[model samples]
Target: MAATFRRAMDALYLLCVIVGCTALVLISAIIPWAVFTRYVLNSAASWPEPLAVLLTIVLTFIGAAAAYRLNLHMNVGYFADQLPQPFRKLLELLVQILMALIALFMIVWGESLVEVTWHNTIADFPFLSVGVTYLPIPIGGLCLLLFIVERIWLGIPPDPIPAHHEVAPFE
Candidate 1:
């Protein structure tokens, strides 16, 4: 059962990575186009800048969740590492609890925010709801919550396998 759950989560993690990377690439591409249209082409489109901002929000939240799952999120663990084994373990639990709390806060507040803004359309995009842009917050929070719960229950997985192109020292 645990193995099955982990496999499912691994798939979800891959999905997060795909979404985040795609958003990031889109942002990179669109920003340049926006700039080109404004300075070079002498005609700026209203949608690109706002669209880039929306994509940025998506990239940040989704990428952050993926980072957390991969244990790539930033932390100051030097002191924690120096502590005795038991103390280190306790500190780990404490940290996980705090993370869980933050995720919970995001879930509650983010949903409220989404609800409040759902009816309002974005200024530049008449058909799009402002709340749609805010979706990453709550969705990322839920993803983070799932990962935190899994960590609390089964502990963090080992580092992921390196990509094919990565150099191996012994090779």
Candidate 2:
């Protein structure tokens, strides 16, 4: 059961990474194009900014889930690290509980937001429902909830991926 859970979580994390990276590349290209169209061509594009914002929302939420699974989320461990082992463990548990609560809040409120905005359409893209834009919120929260459960009930994730090879800068 544990193994299956881990495999599932890994797959989810990989999916999030792919989505986030795709969004990053797309946003990078779109912004420059928007700028060029606005300044160089003297005809500002209407779709790029709104599209970029949507992509950013997706990237931030999904990337955050992946990062949490990988233990890449920010940590201010100086104070906690100074505590004794038992206290440290307690603190860790406390943090996980707090994170789980936050994830739950995201899921609950995000769904409400999505439902409330379901009938509305993006200003620039009238055909697209605004609710669709908010989907990443609950989806990411779901992913995060799973990861937090795994961490609290299962165990710490393995170490970070090791570099495949060392490259010399001069080479």
How many clashing pairs does model 2 include? 0
Q: How far is candidate 2 from the true structure (C-alpha RMSD, Å)?
A: 2.3
Instruction: Residues 1-171, candidate 2: write the lDDT tens digits.
Output: 999998888888889999999999999999999999999999999999999999999999999998988788897899999999999999999999999999999899999999999999988999999999999999999989999998997877774575556444564
Clashes per candidate, residues 3 or more apart or on different chains: 0, 0
Q: State, as a TM-score between 0 and 1, how close model 2 is to the true structure.
A: 0.93
Q: What is the lDDT of candidate 1?
A: 0.89
**Residue pairs that clash (backbone atoms under 3 angstroms), model 2:** none
Each model's TM-score, in the order given? 0.93, 0.93
lDDT of candidate model 2 versus the reference: 0.91
